[model samples]
Target: MIDLHGFGNQLLQGAVITVELAFASLIVGLILGLLGASAKLSSIKALQWIANAYTTIIRGIPELLTVLIIYFGATSVLMSVASLFGYEEYIEIGPFVAGVTALGLTFGAYATEVFRGALQSIPKGQHEAAVALGMGNVRKFYRIILPQVWRMALPGLGNLFLVLLKDTALVSVVGLDDIMRKASIAVSSTKEPFLFYSAAACMYLILTIISMVAVHYMEKKASRGIKRT
Candidate 1:
């Protein structure tokens, strides 16, 4: 049906953009998530407070609002700072940057909690044993702690990634050429809302199915050596 209207090519391009947006946001979110989890689990009270505040503020806000605010707010701030340096040209963030930053912030907030829980789930004795082996802190983390963290965190992180992938559609509002934006254009041109929207939905469903399958495979691989309860 989509191919009949010559909409297939446009939709395919949009899907590529959607995947790029999702992946860029995922990288940013994972980095932030790791840092946030470390900060929250640290002994320093100030670090803990800062991490808690980040997650609390981000999770409390709506994702759409977060995108709008980050895009407009960051643009205004950047322009103001540039003006102070006597470079008053209208500097603006691209839709990609804004979308990735917004979505990544939201993803990181939730991922922080997941990582924190995973890190805590590892028993204290494991660390003790690593030290008993005279392993350095870095080696202990890499060899002993990190692998279990990965195994434990994979499922939750995978779920968050699916949410992040869907959330990439919200970037359409900011003028990204994602599936939703292209579909909207097609609808306007053809005056066929149902066809284009349904096409868009199907594209998203395909992405979700593929992602779920990949996650399941990774989970099975990660579960090796663990006894099934």
Candidate 2:
């Protein structure tokens, strides 16, 4: 049994924070993906242009850069906006908030393409059939189209979530006390870089394994009614 030098609890707490960060980012990304896919598929050229620009710019950059930019830039932006409302003082964005925003944006960019492809893969006949049944666009989408889209998008979204789970380490650079950051601290105190870092690696591996199982279950549930060829 390798000793953690009493830092095991700290690491566990950090792991909890990592899980929270990933889930928060996932929710944000899912919402953005839905909106982005809708915009891309909409008849409005302006919406298409905006969505295209968002995915293009976000996907082109590195995730670390996105985190750094949001972490530092958000504070400045908030300060400027606050000044307009007659508030004086530094409005600092927390590292967790910045982490979520950055990761969510990156995830959403990739998920936009996933969702777009899924939406396109859906047959047009369904839409026509819904129209024939006098279903409004909103009702038709919620009742008929969205379920199929969710089923189709689940695999891609699950993969993206696994990536996001690992990417939570990037938040450590912004001073978030995630697993990486906690391990760094432990290494510094115990001068056991190899041990602590190895422990951190195991933590991440455990997280990935758990996430994989969850994703597999979700995919299974989502595909329940569909017949596989």
TM-score of each: 0.93, 0.94
Candidate 2 lDDT score at position 120:
96
Kindly list the per-residue Cα lDDT of model 2 for residues 91-204, writing each as its tens digit. Answer: 768999999999999999999999999999989898899999999989998999888899999999999999999999999998999999999999999999999889999999
TM-score of model 2 (CA atoms) = 0.94
Model 1: per-residue Cα lDDT over 1-229, one tens digit each: 3583888889899999999999999999998998999999999999999999999999998999999998889989988999999998997698999999999999999999999999999999999999999999999989998889889999999999999999999989989999999999999889999988999999999999999999999998988999999
- Candidate 2: where is the Cα deviation over 4 Å? 1-3, 82-90
Error of 2 at 221 (Å): 0.9
Worst 10 residues of 2 by lDDT: 1-10
lDDT of model 2 at position 20 = 100
Clash count (model 2, backbone only): 0
Candidate-wise lDDT, in order:
0.93, 0.94
Best by TM-score: 2
